[model samples]
Each structure stands twice: as C-alpha cells, then as structure tokens.
Target chain A: MPIYGVALLAGCTLVGLFVGDLIGAAMGLEANVGGVGIAMLLLLALTNLPGRDVGPASPSGAGVQFWSLMYIPIIVAMAAKQNVAAAVSGGAMAITAGTLAVLAGFALVPLLSHLARGGGQRGERRDD
Target chain B: MIDVARFADANGLLVAFVFVGLVMLVSAVLARQVGRGRVHASAIAIALGLVLAWAAGVDTGGKNGVADYPLLAGVGVLGGAMFRDFAIVATAFGARVTDLRAAGLAGALSILIGVVLSFAAGAAVAIGFGVTDPAEIATIGAGAATYIVGPVTGASLGVSSSIISLSIAAGLVKAVLVMVATPLIARRIGLDNPASAMVYGGLMGTTSGVTGGLAATDPKLVPYGAMTSTFYTGLGCLMAPSVLYLVVKALV
Candidate 1:
C-alpha cells in the first residue's frame, strides 16, 4: 500500500460522494444515499481489477487496511456522540425515544433469545 | 506573532483534528489509569466531547457548539459524511462471504427482526410524543435502529435537524445500554457460541455496542457480533428512508 493506493481510495471516496449526492438529488432528498456504500463497492471492484494487483501482501493492501481500520473506531465513535448531543437538546420526544428504545431493546432480548434457540439444553435452560 | 486566532481559523479542520486526537489520547490514558480497562476509551472520549461541545455552545452562543468557533469549524468536516461514510465503506474489506454463512438463517432473521423491532419501538415513542409527520416518525424510528441509520434516513427524507438529532440520541442510548448490559446478561441468554453472538449482534444493530459488549463478555466473539451488527446498520440504512418511511406515511 503505497501513497498511490491511498490516493486511489480518496479518489474513489470523492467519486462515491458525488454519486451519492446525485442520487439524493434525483430522489429529491437532502441526504447522500449510500455514498459510502457505493464508494466501498467501487473500491472493492477497483481493487480486484486487472493489473491492479501489485503482489501478495502488497503495500497497497496494507494501506487500504490501515485507512479502513482507522476510519471505523475513531470517526464513528466521535461523530455519533456529536450527533446525539446535538439532538438530545431537540426536545423531550427524542429523550423519550432514547429511553424507551433502550428499555424495549432489553425487553426484547429474552423473547428473541428464546425464539432463536433451536432446541436441547440451550432451549431447556430458558424454561427453568 | 500575527493573529494566532486567525491561523487557527484558517486551519480549523487541522486544529480540530489535533484537539480530537488529544481528547482520544487523554481518554485512553484516563481509562487505562483509573478505569482499569473496564470503561472503554471510546465511551470516555464521547463524554469528553459532549462536555466540550456544551462548553463551546455556551461560549459561542451558537447551535453547532464547538463548530461555531471559526477555529473549530473543521470539527464539522472531520465528523462529516466524507470521513464517516469512508469508515462505513472500509468495514466491508474485513468481511468474507464464507465466514458469514456460519450464522445462516438465524443471523439473517436477527437482522430483520432487530431493524423492525427497533424501528417500531422508536416510532411508537415518537407518536406518543405527538409527532404527526411521517418522515419525522420514521427518522426517529430509524435512529432507534442505529444512530447511523437515523441521520441517513432523516437526510434522505429531508426531515428537520431536531428529528435527526433525536434519532441519533435514541441510537446512542441503545448503544450504551447494549455495551453495559451485554456482559451482565450473557449467560442468562445463552450467548456462548459464534452463532449466538452473531444473532445477538444482529438483534442489537449498533456495531460499537455489539462489539464493546461482546468484548466485555468474550473477546473472541467480538468479530462475529460486529460482522452482523455492521450488516444491521447497512440494512437499516436501506429500509428506513424508503420502505419504512412509506409504510409510516401510508398509516399516518
């Protein structure tokens, strides 16, 4: 994964953003519809293309891996908090939704786990 | 010493990156020193960010908090879709089709069930709060599915910013619960195997929550839970702004 490979990813991400913006416009929506999803699809396709493979354990592979891994934990963790804080002040509705959703999720678990069980000890344990 | 503030304003994004990096670093150190790894750094960082954003909001008298400052305007771009979406897309590289097959029908079922149930729960809450607009209801509902889903759905539907924010809040609440509760109740739920972990992840849908919770319970199960949770976010994104919104619109 040389600098060029990283550059290619940036290029693909921009292209994907453009395409997503276009889709959002076409649908008359304000959001980019699956821009990252489209970008990932493009990257996957581009990476596997002819002559694209530098070799086994290539630097490009490592580069893409590095960026991808970095993107997830840090960026997602940060943005989600920002978004939530901004919205929590919106009103009581959101607070209600947040609190209820958690409670509902908790209530759903036992029922879901039971339904998920196929049989045997796992299934039997639930009854007790 | 030409205006230091102006330089920060010009390089706001870079400055923001540095500040964010510092926050993450500090959170990690604190978590290590005091939390003994029980409190994840990511959680601590989020709390710190919230406090900073609140301080910035009060100082600047603006809506965007830290982003209201010219020197910190880059926070928006740093946390914007460009990077966020890149991260989401990047997750695909780690996944393999063969590995996904292990979950089979159970995993697949969990994703659908998780999305619908979460959506319904959120939507019900919104309606109880007297929300009439179908788009608003759906956006909040989608947020219940995942914070990522809420914004995507809200943006796609052109809902109000407040609604999108609420969605994110709902998702975050669910995430925190998942993180704290998963470990405490793993045994009672029989969440011991890879297949069960995948199902649990799907049912939860928040990747951070699923991964963190699973990590607290059994680190080996983290990958499996995260894989399905990732899929759950993608699925929620697809359904929330479209099929789910349409259904809600028709009903209301």
Candidate 2:
C-alpha cells in the first residue's frame, strides 16, 4: 500500500497492458485473456478484504471523493488528448441504451421474477 | 489511434467499489454495537473511499500533476474491530425481495446491476462509433468486473480499497440535465431500492462499484437475491454489449 508499491503496481499494470495489446495483434485472444486478468486484478484490489457485515449497510462519502479525485487526471488526459468534442458526440445515445436496459430490468424483470415464483410460493404453501 | 490504458483504468474502479463496501460493511457491525449511530456507512464509505483514491491516484493527479499511488489495504483490516448483530427489516415482504440474508446481497445486487449497465453503455458507444481500440476493450472489461470483485476479494484481503475516476465528469454532465439525462431513467421510475440505482452508478460509478464490492463476502441477500442474481446480471449482460457497440460507434 506504500506509494512506491502503488507506483510499481500501476507501472506493472500498464506494462502488462501494453504487452497484451501487442500480443493481441498476432493472436486475438491475448487482449481478451489479459483484459480478464486485469479485471480480476481490479476485483482483487478491494473486494477481497476479509470481513463480513450482515448488518444494515452504510458507506463513507469521503472515500468516494479521494478515489475520484485521484483518477480524474487520467480521464481528463484521455479526453484532452482526443478530439474531445468528437468523442462525446454520440455519448448520449449510448448511455441511453444502457439506461433503457436498466429500466426494463426493474420494470419487467422484477415482475417476471415474481411471477416465476408464483408456483414456487404455492408449493411452499402446500408444504406448510 | 493511440489508446491509453483505458481498460486498466476503468477496471481499476473495482478497488474503489470494494473499499467503500468494506467500510460500510464494517460500520454496519459498529452500527449494531454502538446502537445505530454511524449507520450512514455510505457517507463514511464515501469519505474513506475518496482517501483511498487519493492514496492510489485513482482520480486526478495531485497539484504536482502526477498520479497518486493506491494504498489502504491494511486499513481494511480494521473492519474486524466491529462485530455486532445487525437488523434488517424486509424492504418488501414475500417473494419480491428475497428474505434479507446479508447486507452484502443488497450491495452485490446493486453492484452487478450497475456493472452490466455500464458495460452496455460502453458497448453502445463503441458500436455507435466503431471503436475497437485495446483501450476501449480494456475499459469495458474493467467495467464488467468492477461490480463483482469485492465479494471475490473480501474473502481474503478484508475491506474493499479504492477504484475510481472517469465517470465523474460524465455524471456531472448528466446531473445538469437529469430530465433529459440517461441516468434520470431511474428518476422516472417509482420507488425501489436506491442502492442499485443506475443514476448512482452514473453520477458515482466508481463509488457505487467500490461499495458494491460487498457482494462476495456477505451472505447473498436472499430476499432480493432474485433481483440481484437474475435481474441485475441478466440485464447487466444484455446492456453491456450494446453499450460497447455504442462506444465503438463513437470512436469510429
């Protein structure tokens, strides 16, 4: 968790990413595999912390701030490097698709899931 | 034409998501022990998450214009200091919400829902723009994994850490136009659990993703488990590819 180590990890992640990109050119699977590896690494970073609270949940607002602040430079750098206006042109439509899907999930999925359990509930009643 | 480490950067949101989750989860225990004082674990989690982000450079570079390094892994261990019984009233009874199993189930369900949607949004951008950059792929992959990692890691490492950046600006833009905004889709809908709310992910994907890390360690929220597993993931998967397509389209 030291700064030096964090630097080292970030560097390694970039190196790994670069290597994977290059390798992916020859064989399409490299990026896919490496990407998954990266995903796993991210998952491993925080969620793996040991301890479980099966209680009412709460999260710190400050934690979200520091993390976002730290990472903003990276995003801005990416945007600034590009034709920012161009890249953002269709960003709205894309987000729209996702928004729709989520809404559908809440509206339709919840109802369907409940209906699926209708028989399950009846069976439970019989057992009771 | 040159792609940055976009995937790696995006995937990095996992750390932030999990770390928030760990802090909240720990506080949940404390909430029980201290008799319900700091139950705003989300508030505490946001604070701690921001600190972790700063420590890791998960967000903007410091005034020095360099990335920050991530730490706070050890800080997560303090979660154990809190050990107390928690009480959860069923948000809704019967089949709709799976019987409340663990606080984590709620987080996980929400996290998974958030991830799947993010993936879709990314895919849509990709397809809409025809982007096949390694950076974009990496970004989408990271998005997919961010939500589910906390449960995976919490088994060993302890509390979640920090994963962040990217979505804040986008969220800000959306916040400005909530009525016409994509994230506002949640607002259009009626009452429900706000944890898995898409707007939360949009405005604060990093925070929600990091907090969502609780899915792994805590008992699956059996009551809402149906929504968590089937709905969140089901919809999440469906949405990711489309979003990816959109990302590609935008880039192209």
Candidate 3:
C-alpha cells in the first residue's frame, strides 16, 4: 500500500501544468504535443517515491482499495451532471488528452534515458 | 424488468456505488482459484463491469449527469491499479538502469512528436467546428474544468489561465520534468532515480501540485506529501477557472 499514491496525483497534475505553462510562456512557446509529452514523463518520475511495494503483484490491495473506493465520490460528481454520451461529447477532449498523454509518456521513457546521460557527463555528482 | 434509467435518475451515485461494489464482490469470489486465475479474472471482471454498465442504460450519454457515476467509480479503481503497476516497473528499471544520459535525448524527441500530434488533432477539430476564437474556446474549457476540479485551480495556477493551453502545456512540461527532477529528488529522498521518476511523474500527472519529488520519493515525507498534494490539487481544480483566467491574461 503506497501511502500517498492518490493523495498526490490531483495536486501535482494541476500545478505541474501551471508551472509548465509558465515555463512555456517564458520560452515564448505554448503547449504542443511534444511539450505535453515531456510533462507526462515528468509525471511518471514524480510519483515513484510514495509508490513502493504497492502493486497487485505484491499481494496487498488494502491501500489502493481504500483510495479507489474514495474515488466514488469524485466519480459521482463527475457523472453528476452528465452521462456517457455527455462525457464523450463534453469530455472527448479530455479523453483525447488522457490518451495522448500516455503516448507521450511511452515516447518519453527512452528520451529521458538519453537526457540522463548528458546530465551525468557534467560530473560524477550523485544527488541521491 | 430493470428500468435502469429511472433507478439512476433517482439514486445515481448510490446506484453507481452499489454496482461497483457488486463487481468487486464478484471479482473477489472468483479469486478462490489457482491464484493465477485471479489475475485474469480481475481484468475480465473490469471489462465486464464496463460492459454491463454501458448496456444497463447507465445514461452516460445523456444530460442528467447523475447516471455516469457508476462508470467513474469503476474507472477510478482500475486507474489506481494500472498506476500502481507502472510504479513497480519504474522501480525495477531504476534499480537496473544506470545510464540516464541517453534517456534525455530520447525524451526530447518523443515529446516533440507528441506535441505535433496534439496540434494537428486540435487544429483539425477547430477547423471542422468552425470555431475561430481560440481564446473563447479556452475560456469554455476553463469553465468546464472548473466544474470538474473546482475552485482549487485558482490558487494553484492563478485566476487567468487558459484551460486548453494550460492543460496541454502542463501535461507536457511535467513529462520533461520527470527526467530533470526525478534523479535529484530520488537522491534527496533516498530512492532510485528511475523509480522516483516513474512514480513521481504519475503522481504529478494525476495530481499536479507537488513541487520537487522530495515529498513523493521520501519514505518519511509520504504522508505529509500525500495530504498536502491532495488538498492542493483538489483545491486547485476547484479554482481552475480563476487560475486559467490569470494564465490567459499573463500569457496574452
């Protein structure tokens, strides 16, 4: 059971975007797919800490089960004003956003590996 | 015999909860097998649940909104499981993979391709719809986001950010930050970088409020980080409108 898996997802995704936007603006760039792609990779790395030994293969569903149940309320709210058709219509972009985000993520895994190599050449500095 | 539409309209959330609970219960019952049977059953159960919900006239395609509650609950649970799996994969990789230098180059190219795809898709949609005002569309998106996440977005991103642009921009930047910040944070928190990056990236992607990976990666910081990040993102989502507005003003 990861202590902070769901607990941190909401805030980081939203704020990460804001920060990303600010950075993008600074660079005179708005978000294209690539920018969003990097952000997805960033998200994958950010969640690693609180997520230790808390997967199905590990044989414990207590932690995630609780959070998953808690999401009922949020989902209730999500469906409170719409239905499947509505979600697909109103949320088509969001769904698109989610799907695209994952694709961006897959592409990022390898790219980040390359970037890490460059960062290493600077020095044998292990912050960890 | 079952008039699902009527039931949902009257007790949508409760109805949804009951349905999801039943599905979980069924999955649990199926687990008394050869062990491996449970894993396959779990996935099958999830798919069945989605199918049942859709067929039972869940009304996710209607205007009442209350009908879709069941779907959300189910999806949420599944999403958590999938995310948990991704975390484990990252952890394993970090323990094994040492050469992060190469990962960064791959990161840039991948993100570039993703961004182009998003633009093409968005442009095609905009052109098809005959919608000329990008700002107006962004504003509408901000409002919709406000409805879902709430006023929390205001405090986090500001009151004038654009929803379309903000979401696209944030989603990607967080992706890049995964590589830049994960290792440093992993070290600070005493975890491996790859593990840190994968888990942290997922957290920030879903939550969107944590700063460095310190809160997410550290064992001791998990509880505090979880609480803080939860409150902030929920609050930020609520305030999304104000934040989006500010972003738009500042950027434009």
Candidate 4:
C-alpha cells in the first residue's frame, strides 16, 4: 500500500535529517544540511536495488510512485506558505535574480544539447 | 446545526488539503479552457496559491497567510518544512537508472552546468542588488536552482524567513516561465528526441515545468525529461547549502 511507501519515505527522511544535522554540525553550521537530498538518494537507492521487485510495479512501489507524482500539491503548499507580498515589497532583486537565472539556464540549453548530441546518438544506437 | 468553525479548527490539515484540492481542480480546468494546454496546471495552481496567500495576508494582516484564519490553521502545518521535505524526497522514487544511462554523460553534465549557471546568475543578481551576506546570497542562488532547494538551503544556512520566501518566489518564476516557453521553442532547440529532452530537463531542473512543457511538446518525452530533472533537484539540494555556500562565503 501507499502507506508502506510513506513508511519507507519517513524512515529515509529521519535518517537523512539526522545525517544532515551531523554534516551541519561538522561544518560548524547550526542547521540540517541537505537532509532532503540525502533522503532522496536513499529512496532512489532502496527502490532500485538489484534483482529486487521493489520497483514501481510492486505494491510498496505503487505507494512510492503515487507520492512521487504528488509533488505538485506539495510544491503548491510550499508556495502558499510563502509571504508573497513581503517578498515582492522587499525588493526587485528576487524577480530580477529569478528571471536572469532562468534566461541563463535557457541560453545554455542549446549548447548542452549540441555537446550531448554525439554521445546521445551513440547511446541510442547501442539501445537499438 | 454543527459547529462548523470549531470542526474546521480541529481538522485544519484536512481542510487545508481539501482547499488545496479545490484550487488544483480549478487550476486544471483553467489550464485546459483558458491556457489551452500551453500552460501547465501546476503552474497555474502555484500562481493561484500565491494570489490567495497574498489576499489572505492583506485581509488578515497576518504573516502566515490563510493559515491565520482559524479554519485553515492547518495550512501552516501542511505547508510546513516537514511536509515539504518529505514530498521532495519522495519524488526521487520516480527516477529510473536506465533512463539516466540513455541520456549519457551530457545529461549528467547538463545538470551540474544547469545548477552552477543558475546559481551563479542568481548570486550575481543578489550581489548586484547589494546583498552583502553570503548565506542570504547562497540561499537565493539555490532558489534559482529550484524552489525546494532554496528553502532547504536557507534553513540549513539559518537565513531569515523573508529571504527564504524571496528564494521561493524566484524559483516559482523560473518554473512558470519554463513551462510557458518550452513548446514555443521546442523545434528550434531540437527538443523532439528523448535524448535532447533529457538534456533539456537537466538544464531546466524544475520537474513540474519540464514535465508539463514536455507533455505539451510531446508526451513520449516526458519520462526522459522528468528523470534528469529529478536528479537536478537532488543535486541542487546536496550542493547548494554545502559546497556552494562555502564558495559564496569565500568570494564574498
């Protein structure tokens, strides 16, 4: 069931958060560092175990799959949690930074695609 | 009659879930009927959420937006850091190793390049805006990587809440723009194939935006794009608050 997935995710999250805190402490920082990222790595590793039937097709995997796609709601919730008026009134910097960053990212897409084309073509041939 | 207000207060999280569901339902309809599928429903939902939060802030004169209302008090917890992190981590479950292999080295490089370039652009803008603190700058730059990364980095760095909010706003803008722009420029960018799609996903780094944009461009490419994009967020989360923060500190 999806609950099992949630259980697995919860375990990963706790372990991840603990490790993140340890890392932060080691770095002389006061916060949990990369806890969510660590949890994701754990989940990815667990779900992709070799010769395991725990892939998305399995029951627990179904739970994992369901929550994985449910990120939209979570994202929306996160957005809603923000104080937009405060952020906007604070300065033009946020918008400016965001827009420029996106533009920069967009500009690089073509270059990366071109660079990847040769390698991607070889991979495609091997797969075929 | 039932004491509805008290009941809502008691079930705030449930109410918040129901309320967000309604908003999403409406957003999906709007995306189809008004946006004509060019825009992703999640983008519209985010926009709507921001507007509602703004309205709630103005109406109640409170900091937590709609959560200030007793009936929606659960929004505070529902949208809290705990659930946010849980959701983000769970997204990794959808990624497949085979998909990553198909995209090759370019796919991996694109993610690193995308994260660094986006972070640098954001940090530069923050510096231009006269932000002197490295932590704040790194947090904002991480937000440029993705919304999830921004807050995670901010919380890790112990930056102010307002700064974290700004970071999220920055990421949101990127996601919306990416969703709207992908189809319009797909052909010109040669995003017709799965390999290119994966690279595009790595570059964009917003799973929802990449998936939505690719779905509009070609449904067959969504899986490929989403896989790398998922990795993008993970990489951003891992790097932003640690290595990137130190780098910003050194420079500043």
Q: Judged by DockQ, which candidate is best? A: 4
As a whole number from 0 to 100, the lDDT of residue B136 in candidate 3 is: 37
Q: Write the per-residue lDDT of candidate 2 for residues B213-238, one digit (tens) a residue.
A: 21221223222333333233223222
Q: What range of 10 consecutive residues in model 2 chain A has the weakest lDDT sum?
A: A75-84
Per-residue accuracy of model 3 over A1-128 as CA lDDT, tens digit each = 34454344333444545665665477454431112222233444553335455442333333333444444233222222222332233344543443343344444443344343455555554542
Better of 2 and 4 by DockQ: 4
lDDT of 3 by residue, B1-252 (tens): 976656555564465566556665665566445332313333334334433433432444433332335433433333232332222222221111122222233323332333333333333333344444444333333222212232122212332322322332323233224323443444433334443343333233323222233333443534322322232223223223333434444543
Q: What level of docking quality does candidate 1 show? A: acceptable
- The sequence of per-residue lDDT tens digits that candidate 4 reaches over residues B6-112 is 99989888888898898899999999999988788888998787778778877887777677778887777878888888888888888876777777998999999
State every prediction's TM-score relative to the real structure: 0.84, 0.35, 0.36, 0.93
Worst 10 residues of 4 chain B by lDDT: B94-103
Query: Superposing every Cα of model 3 onto the true structure, what RMSD results?
Result: 13.6
In candidate 1, which residue ranges exceed 4 Å CA deviation?
A: A2-31, A38-58, A72-92, A106-126, B33-36
Deviation from native of the Cα of residue A95 in model 3, angstroms: 4.9
DockQ of 4: 0.63
Q: Report the lDDT of model 1 for residue B221.
A: 93
- Candidate 2 Cα misplacement greater than 4 A, ranges: A11-68, A85-128, B1-252
Q: How large is the i-RMS for each model, in angstroms?
A: 3.6, 12.9, 12.0, 1.6
Candidate 4 CAPRI assessment class: medium
User: How do the candidates rank by lDDT, highest first?
Assistant: 4, 1, 3, 2
